[model samples]
Target chain A: MNPNTAWLRKTVALVILIGVWEACADLGYFDPLYMPAPSKVAVALFQLFAQGTIWPHLIATFSAALGGLVVGLVVGTVLGAVAALTPLVGELLAPVMISLNAVPRVVLAPLFVIWFGIGVGSKVALAFILVAVLIFFTVFTGIRDVDRRLVERVITLGGGRGALLREVYGPSVIAWILGNLKVAVGFAFTGAVVGEFVAATKGLGYLLSFAQSSYNAALMLALVVLIMGFVLLLFGLTGLLERRLLRWRG
Target chain B: MLRVDSLALAYGATPVLEGASLEVPSGKFVSLVGPSGSGKSSLLRAVIGLQQPLAGVIETDIGAGDIGMLFQDDALLPWRTAEQNVALGLKLKGVAAGTAIASARQWITRLGLYGLSERFPRELSGGQRKRVALAQVLAREPQLILMDEPFASLDAIVRARVTQDLVRLVELRGISVLLVTHDLEEALALSDVVYLLSHGPRARISGRYEVNLPRPRDVIKARSHPDFAPLLQRLWNDLSREVGERAA
Candidate 1:
């Protein structure tokens, strides 16, 4: 299908679902206070904007996600590269990553909050934890699975370690990095939202918790929609960057 | 001239070439025809430092040009353009980008990729990619080119075209070429001298033939010659026996 038509189809499907939700609420099949209609959520979103209360939460969530993604990406890539290029390091660290990765990162958010407090620091730290293992495995596998002949070819051409890393390893791992980003970007928002839910003074997660406690279903739905929109925006940008960087691979 | 004296090349305990010896005269095409595992590739690898001989001296008497290798698989980088792949040799020589690109394009044209310089290896057909690979080594202006089963992947028609292209290019350049193939016809078709390699604990040069075949030798024309059938049969018998013994 054409990309435009595919996108239009998705939009129409979402509109139909919203129409059903509105009709159900209107007929009293569901309590509007507990399960707000799409219309109620939209009005709640406008009210939040008018009150100027959503900006701080949006900024807080964006900051945590971006900061964590940057740190995780840098450190993960380096660590993964070192593991790939050096056998000793890979062996030493293999078990540690396996064990840590097996544990749900959400299980550690409370620990982060306890240690770093209910601040941006805790949320950022939690997001980093969420993204690091995924990035590391992707990049390490990227480097490890490089073409053996290409490496030998480079060596034959008088290329040293630096050149092998630059030409062969860089190109080989780029695909893996992009593949993992599809998952890791989502994890970044997840880390932020979950961190906010557990303990945070300001953020979408905090709003989610407040909405639940105050029995404001519309506010909660509105915040959830806003967070999903933000995540989708970031995902789209990552895809754009992946396409640009990987154009030559074709 | 090159000499492999008292060479011992093996994989673990299994010897591929033991006490092997060879002498290749300069500026001539020498084809190594042998069974699949008769140390043909090992000899080439050892010469290029891809493998180390247990005992031997691979002496290059006249070494002005860098060694150019055409790998068994073509080995073209998947991400490189036809032009970029050809420019690899020049890149190793540290040529400026403009000069390197121009030189690469010149040889690429000669190698029959005139309009497809910007296409990647994956984009080209098998024969076209092989020609691009040929251009890669030719652009290096090497004193000697070691080709390992370079044309094995091409169909009969494309292979014939590439062989002629190689002959014309070799004639113009006068570079020494060592073409390795299991195909006896290809060996006789291209080389000035053909060395039939025996299976090894020592792979010996069992027999040698001097083609002295005229320029522009066609694959079709060569087959019609009186000597072609006899030559083909001889290689079949020799290489097959060697392979069976190794398998046994």
Candidate 2:
């Protein structure tokens, strides 16, 4: 398929779907209270942005998610390297990391809120746990899965432990971490949003809760669209980063 | 310069190599040829210290850090450029970055891979990648080189060219080599001494031949030497006998 035509087809399909939804709502196919018209959601989205009511919420969520992501990545990489390099540490940390990975870490959001008191700390904590566990596993497996032949080659080339880590394990871990960055970003946002949803002063999730209590379906859908758009934007950025960092793979 | 005395190797209860002994005198090129599963690669791994021997001793005057090894598969790091890959050993040894890269570039050019220093392994063709791997090994200037059929994957023409380059480099540097190969012709053309290993289960040295071929040999043209064909036939018969014994 031609790239331009493929994109045109996607836009046409999305436009048609929205038109159908609008037509159904206008024809009273569903209750307006539960399923608002697309136009109504769009208007709500416009009002929130034009009135600037979402600025504080957007800033709050963005900072919390970004902060958590950076911290989680650093901590996870350090811990993963330590585990992979030292046999005793690897054995000691394996069960703990495995158990943490087994659970849906998002469920801990409410407890984090209770401890950190509905501030950015709670959201950051939730996002940190979510991303750290994921990146930890990625780095750990990445190092372990390196080709044994490559390791032997490096050794026979007079490389020692430090050289092995720098030349072999280090690049392998970077690729794994970047490859998983998309999921980590999603998890970070999920953590921030879910924490706010459970309890928070100002965030997209807090607005969602408010929309829920008032039964404002149009506003709720608007916020959902906003959140999805932002996450998709972040996903695109991470993909570009992955391509740049792993250009050697070509 | 290198000697393996009654080396034994096994995987659990299954013996792969038994009582295998060989020697590579300084500045000599030695080859080990064997049938499939006859522990030729296992012996090379043991010599390089990648695999521990079940029993016996390996003695060498060269230190561990002075050894270089080439594999059948190109083991260049995917993330590093050809030049950087060649410079890795120098960098590890604390050679300054500029000097290391300059030396790497020189070796890369010497291997007929000029102007491809910036290409990654994935971007290079199989033959070019093999050349880069050779440069990576040779740039280190190792005193002892171990090869495990390093040219088996290349086309015949490319293999002959690489063999010529390798012979020139090894001779110019006076490096000792211990090669593992299944090709009797390749062994005859490149090695001063060729050892035939018996079929596995308990593989051991079955025969040894000394080739008094002149130095500065051309790998492809050397096969046309009067003595080459007869030596290859003798090695081939010994190898077939080992295979026949295994089947019987």
Candidate 3:
């Protein structure tokens, strides 16, 4: 639990991962044509960056991911808040959400492609479908977990419905919402990449699919890492905002 | 006057208060003293309309002035400033923004929190939070008040100070209170009358004693008051005896 120990522990994990990858590559258990070495992946990333191919794919995927995140956040928050406060709506929507969650969103990609075309719109739409449910479940559980004791305390002070929501439930649920926002963004990013892979004219996922068709294994790995890096950047920024929201908790 | 008549209260199916009746006149600070699970809190909850009395009449005659209830932890909104939390009740009653907020705010200053208005609940200490809650309640200018062990969470010194401030505030506002507490000295120190509740499947008022001690009374000095020790000893003995009798 010590701060210094945690830093060292993370360093050890990174070293171990790289060490294992290098050892596997040196052993030649797998052919380099099928599985590129990490150094080759790094070289492919540098080559893509030099040719200015990485930036366009980065921009394409980032747009889809960010758009999906925004739509998911707004719609999910509205649904979650409404569902938590109103039992009838909650009961009606609960089953529908479960079914939606169960359905493979990839199966709907072709439908989205037909509806929105093979552009960013189709990708964004597909991502939204995937991300919205993650946000809904997290935020709903957040509101549900609010302390009943605190609500009673507010009510006994003669707080009306709106006041109880504002003072008791809203503040109480912020920690949950923010905690889930990070994971929700990750889900949204995953949805975006999956959408791009299914049918996309451009994006890191498209680049990945294109590289695999050409048997450019290192380029595919580079594109995969780049997408993960983009996800991490957005995720890190959200975490910063989360820390601000929870400063009151400290 | 507050009338709790023929009250039958319960937590789910298990009954707690069976045919309980008590009358609290306006402008008196009364304490309900009891052992644990004696329906003191349940009675307070029933009075506040938070818990239904199952089958009884809890009548409130005065309806004009705003009412306030204070809990042990103060329960201030962590995101709100001291002044904003204090003025929340005014906002809740659909009070006009300009006038209600302006009038509601002067109390924080009057109650020694003049410049600390913008500080959030997390920034304040335990004693300061209690003061904020007190200011919050006082800002309502309630004719009737209810407290569920408001000062029980404070240390002895802070409790004494807050209790003193409370007595002064009550006198200034002429607020009628029905307080629930397990602290006998606290009950004796602040109450004009004390009602003792005994524990059971159906808890009832075991004894009612008039606290003849003069205000503004302090607990340290209360023990030395001519009637204090005897009253304390009597309540203590009765409560112990009741518990023992029940155990047997």
Candidate 4:
């Protein structure tokens, strides 16, 4: 199928589904308090932005997620590279990384809140842990899976360990990192929001807590939609970055 | 000159090559042909020090950096342009970026890849990629080159053209080659000397032939030489016997 047509079809399907939901709500088949109509959610979304009440929450969430993402990317890459290049380090680090990867690490959000307090620090800490483990695995496997023939070619050309790292493994690792970047971004946001959901003074998750306490279903849906929209926008941007960086792969 | 004497190679307890021996004199091209699973590639790997030998000796006057290799796969870095890929050896050897790139451009053109310097490996055809790989190996000016069925992936026409270019380039530069292939005709056409390896539980050199064919050789025309047919027939018969014994 043509990509544009596929996109158009998806849009039409969503619109039809929303139209059905609105019709059902108008017909009173559901409780308005529990299943707020799409129109009511839209009003709630518009009011949240227009009243300027959501700006601080938006900024808080964005900064924490982005800060954790940057630090995690850099630290994870350095540590993973150190492990991959040194056998002793790799053997020591492997089991720890494997176990970390196997667990649902978000449960540590409460501990992060206790250590960093119920603020941006806690959210950033959670985001960092979530992203770091993911990127560490990406870099470790990327270096290990480098084509053996390419390594041989570099060695035959008089490349030592340093050259092999710079020439053969470096670019390949970057490609792998970029390929996994979207997932990492998603994890970063997840960490931030979930940390806030557990404990926070100000964030989208704080607003979610308020909505839950007041049983305001319309406000809850509005916040959820706003977060989804922002994440999708970031996904599109990262995709552009991937295409630019990996033009050679085409 | 490169020489391997009584080389024995194995992967764990599975012996690949035993008592294998060969030679490639300076400025001469040599070929090693064998049935599949006869450890032809293992011998090449052992000579290059990529694989450790179980026992035996490889003696070479070539410096550690003075050897180049071409594989059946092009092995070009997919992320680098043709020119950059060619320049990789020079860059790794500590050539300044400007000089390395200029020299790479020259080799790219020399290999009939004009105007393709900016193309990545994925953007090039199989034949074009092979030419770039050849340039990559030759740009370093290695004293000896080892090839493992380097042209086996090309179509017959592309193979003929590439072999012609290879012969011309290697001969012009006086670089010795030790090529491993199962193609009897390619071995007969390209080599000054050919060694046939026996089928393995423990494979070793089973037969040898001297190609008296003249130099400045054309790959296609060399095959039509009156002597070409007989040498190919003898090599084929020997190889077929190895395959037949494996079946038995």
Candidate 5:
């Protein structure tokens, strides 16, 4: 399928969905209090932005998520590389890492809040753990699965250990990480918001809690749409980077 | 230019080749032909220093860095462009970026891949990938080249063309070559000398023949040479017996 046509089809489907949703609300098929029309949600979104009420929460959430993502990506990649290069270390840590990953990250958000307090520190820490485990597995497998023949080719060409890491393993790991960026972004956001839901003074998650207490469905839906917008933006940015970096894949 | 004496190779406790010896004189093409499990790949790995022999001495006048290898699977890095793959050896050697790029581009052009330098290995056809791999090896300017069935997966016409081009390019550079292949015709057509090995569990060089063909030989037409039929027949007779014995 042509890419343009695929995009067009998706846009049409979304438009039709919104049209049906608005029609249902206008025709009183659903109560606006529970299922607000798209236009009402848009108005709520506009009011929040115009009053500048959402900016602080948006910034707080963005900072915690992005900060955690960077920290996790770096730490996980380094640890994974060390594990891959040294088999003994990998063997020792494999089970421990797997067990940690198996634990529900949401359950740990409360512990992080108690430890790091109710600031962005706890949120960032929670997001870090979630993103770290994910990226660690990715980097570890990527490094291990690097083609031995490719490494041999480099070695025979006079490449040493450093060269092998740079030429053979580095690009492979980067490709794997970039391939999973969309998922990583979603996980990072989930970690941040979930941390806020457990305990937080400011964030989109805190606003969600506030909207729930007031029984404001429009505000809740608006915040949800805004969060989705940010996630999509980050996902799109990563996709652009993937295309630029992996142009040779063409 | 290269010599292996009394080489004994094993995979852990299991022996593969024993009492194997061979030589490739300067600027000559030598081939080792054997069945699937006869340890031809193990020998190549040993020579390239990726594997160590149980007991043997491999002597070469050139430095390890001056040897280029073409793997049986092409082994081109899937993430790198053809030009980048070709330029990798030079880059590893600390060549200036401009020099490496220039050299790689020249090889790409020479191998009829002028517009394909930016394409990754996965985007290329089998024949095109082989050509790119060949260009990579040639660009390394190695004094000796070790090829492990570099043309194995290519179609007949492409194989013949690639073989002919490889011979012409290597001969022009006066580079010694040691090729391992299962195809008797490929071995006979391309080499100055061919060694036949018995099948495992203790594969050895069962026979060796010197091809007295002239230089700049066409691999396609070499089969029709006057001496080609008899030489092939004799080697086939020896090889067939080994195959039969292994089957038994």
Candidate 6:
């Protein structure tokens, strides 16, 4: 469990896997047309970046994902707070939200394309739906789950409605939202890519579809690696924010 | 000053207290001691406006804002720092940020938690968290304070020390306190007047004893006082009889 040894073990495992993969491809264990070696994928990744062919797709995807995340967070927080604080609203909305959540959100991508057209708008809308549902449930439950004792303490201190929200429910909800940011990020990305796959002029998902049509396995795997990198970067940023905001949990 | 008369408290049809009454005079420490499930906490809750008394008259010269309460569980906000927790009441009262911070700092320092102002409740020990809770209540500068077994969770030595510090602070500020606890010795050590409540179905004030002990009494050493044993024995006799009767 030593940090250094853990890091070394992970590195060795990855290296061995890639070595075996390269050996199999070089020995022609599989057709290169369908399965490219790790080296070919790496070269394709380098060329895609060096030739700047990936910039537009990357930017399109990033913008759509970021936009959806922001919109979802804001709208979900408002709805969740309303649902938690008002019983009538919760009674009216809870079942509707549950039904929406039960449906496979990905299936909505084609309908969204038909509604919003094959552009960033459709992708943004899809991502918004995905992230909003997640954040709504989390914030709603978090607010409701705030310790009643803490609320009573605040009221005894002469705190009013605003104070209850600010001091008691606000921090609790924020903590819950931050705790689930990793999942939210992944869902947002999935929403954007799925929307693009159904219909889009530009984006990593569009490029992936194009690569599939051409049967260029190296390019397809290269795009897959690129998407993973983007998701990882977002995940890392969210982690940093989580640590800073939840330092009290230490 | 707080006065409750002919108080009847119940949850739905189940009666918890009936004809329970007590008074906390200005600048006096009063304790309510009783067996468990004797409706002590219910009375405190009714007084604090967290619950409604089925029928009672609670008269107080102080406004709700001028009264502070300490919960049995400390109830410190887990996400806020010690200083921020103390500053909460001030902020709620519309005190300026700078003044609230300054006052919070002073209270934290006075409670011997100066360097720990930035620590969260989870990062603090049980004793340290209790001190922070005390600081939080004291910082509000309430004319009257209500405590529901605030130090019940601490060890004997820590509880004694906290009680001493609390007494000194309340005395210095001339704040009246109404404390509820099951610990007979704690009640006798800290209060000028102790009211013992009988066991429930309809708990009522069964007896009252005045501790003629002087002010600034050392709660730890006060037990060894010549007058301490007899008062303790008398209260215990009344309380144990109620408990035994209830068990039967």
In candidate 3 chain A, where is summed lDDT lowest over 10 consecutive residues?
Answer: A149-158
Off by over 4 Å in 3: A1-40, A102-117, B94-106, B109-116
Best by DockQ: 6
Q: Could you report the DockQ of all the candidates, in the order they appear?
A: 0.47, 0.79, 0.47, 0.78, 0.73, 0.83
Q: Which parts of model 4 are misplaced by more than 4 Å?
A: B245-248
Q: Global lDDT for candidate 1?
A: 0.83
Residue A45, candidate 4: C-alpha displacement in angstroms: 1.6
Encode model 1's per-residue lDDT on B84-149: one tens digit a residue. 888876787677878889999998898777899998787899998888888878887877888899
TM-score list, all predictions = 0.92, 0.96, 0.88, 0.96, 0.95, 0.97
Candidate 5 chain B, which ten residues in sequence have the lowest lDDT sum? B88-97
Query: Per-residue lDDT tens digits of candidate 2, residues A1-250?
Result: 7886997899999999999999999999978999999999999999999999999999999988998899999989988888887889999997899999898998898899889898999999999999998888898888889888788878888788988888899998999999999999999999889989999999998999999999999999999999999999999999999999899995
Native-referenced DockQ of model 4: 0.78
For model 6, residues B31-136, the per-residue Cα lDDT tens digits are: 9999888899999999999989988799999988889999889899999999999998788777898999899999999998879998999989999999998988
For residues A217-244, could you state the per-residue lDDT of candidate 1 as single tens digits?
9999999889888788878998898888
The CAPRI-style docking tier of model 1 reads acceptable
State the weakest 10-residue window (summed lDDT) of model 6 chain A: A1-10
lDDT of 6 at A192: 89
Candidate 6 backbone collisions, by pair = none
Categorize the docking of model 6: high
User: Model 2 - which docking category?
Assistant: medium
lDDT tens per residue, model 4, A220-239: 99999999999999999999
Q: Which stretches of candidate 6 lie over 4 Å from their true place?
A: none
